[model samples]
Target: MGAGTGPDGSSRSDEEWERFLRESMAGAADAPKEPSARARDVAKRLRMDPARGAEGWRSYTPARPKRRTGWYVAGLLALLTLLVVALAPGRTVDLFAGDDRDSAPLAGETARPTQAPPAEEAQRPTAQEPFRGSPAARWASGAAGITVPKARAVGWMSTAEVERALARSRDFLVASSLDRGVLRGERPEKAIALINPHQRDVQDLLKTAFRTPGEKSDPLLLFSRFRPSQARLVGSVVKTRGRLTYQEGERGALQVTADVTFVYPVTRADAGGGDEIVRTIIRRELVMSWDDPDKVITKPGTFSIVSYKYTMTNGGCGAPTGYFTPPFGADRRADETDREIDPYDRSGPVGGGGSGGDECARATRS
Candidate 1:
């Protein structure tokens, strides 16, 4: 047996020699001449081996350029068309599809009805109601009633309401010729004893002023007319005071007190025989006492007392002039005497006396 045999019964080495001869003869016939010395030197430096050098010299053939279809452009146009359709108005987008249109009127179609004027605005009373049951109304009624009228006028009363309020007050008015003579200062003790059957001595002087027809019966007006000559008498007094006291078994509560003072000038008719009888009446103080009602007693808040003062000169009334003080702590001290504040000086804060030193003097001289 031979080492390795081909189909021709020749050795494998003999076959290989035949194949190499054929390639060498073919290459020698078609190839160009040898390179220059520089090329030879470069090829030697590159360490080219005939078998491996074929790989290094092989050329690269690029793939065919791909054809572009119009599908991508069409797809982009389609996407833009879809976006336009989605965003355009009048597309019937149902944001509130379940809403019932038949149940309510359109906002723009209906108009609102006009409102009627207030009762006060439409019809003013020929004569104002004597007392409005408010402090402002009471003050206004008092001021207007005491002033001389533009023309003679009369005020009406139901007689029922007056009697009711009087009953609550435990007082009544009685007409007496002897009592009427005494208010003009004929006999002081006798008139005082006569009309003061209820023993409300303070009210006896007031009744004398209203005894004339067409004048409203009001304590404030009565008091003002009873004293018509003093300068200090022009202002109204609002009294404020407070006390902290412990009770038997409970915690201490703040007790607040308020009173109104009215001064009237004495006319010749009010004072007979030259007696300087200026009737002064101090309204009973209204008191409000409470615990930490809002539970805000611990916080710093102010309790205030406000007063409105007006002047009556030459039978005409003046507007009210007033002031307000800001918030303060619960432990602050309040003085009733400080109510006589100066109207001119704005530098001194309220609750503190300003140029009030001459007020007493000014009042006395006027």
Candidate 2:
């Protein structure tokens, strides 16, 4: 950044504070060694008393100068001044003279972080006030090329801070996504443990999963019309991972998310009353929001997973809808309405088309 003027602050309105920050940031890259000092000088020049005029910092000399020092003392003092000037970088007195969290008072007192009125407290906008930063709009295509609106950190968000937030976001996502093994084993407890205990959603999912654990039934799943046989189907399933990314949210929250592909080979009885081999694929985007995060994500990340799945219905083939697409994966074969497939046909993105898949299927059934 280079030195530049900001929004007209000559009027010194509350809005001026933001302008000052804009100016400060404009020259931030080439900032002087003494940034605090530079800030003070800028503030002083802008009028530590923006609301006041000449009465603010008028200077008054004593009635008469006292012959306090002799020439010998004067010479030493001058020499000392020269040495200090040569040795030190530009130095200025504290402008704010107040505690941390940046802000300068416009009333000639010391600068300080401004407190918000009761009405504005909910957002908890930062002390920067005028410089709470700007909004950044971004969008990403999730599981089915469906664009999800998201945000990017802008303004005061240092590159380091953004990266730090994103990394933690990713940590939460990868750790929180559903694990096929856990699901297949009917270890709902294990799946629930992956989520952050702080989230209400985790508790809700847990209550539902364990509502009647010993009975080999899940009323919630049954209520939602999810098949009990789906559990058995997952026992022999395969899943693939896709892209991972992060997005900023309101009040500086960051969200990390991933796209995963789940595949299940099924032996559903066809409407024709004949046995047919079918494969079902679901693409799910798992998201976890990190409103607060550790500076470093050294521990396994945890957050409730929010999921979205996209599978198109098009083919006349009555084949189950599939989700995985090319790049991270390929879409399952789509043209087959009611066509019978070989029990070991592994030609699709998933299922037992290859020899290894055939063997796995045989072993799974056995």
Say what the RMSD of model 2 is.
36.6
User: Per-residue alpha-carbon lDDT of model 2 for 103-170, expressed as tens digits?
Assistant: 32122111111331111112222212211111100111112222222345633345565566455544
Candidate 1 on 1-366: residue-level lDDT in tens? 444667888777766767767989778666798898876775785685555555443357579987666888898989987786689632422333332211221122011113311122221111122111211222221212111112111122133532232222111111111123222223234323322233233345345533431222222222122222221221232111111111111133333332222223222332332322222222222222222324323221222111212222122111111111111122112212232322211122222112122211111111
Off by over 4 Å in 1: 1-138, 143-167, 170-258, 261-366
Q: What TM-scores do the predictions have?
A: 0.17, 0.31
For each candidate in the order shown, give its overall lDDT on alpha carbons: 0.27, 0.35
**Candidate 1 vs. true structure, TM-score:** 0.17
Q: Name the candidate that leads on lDDT.
A: 2
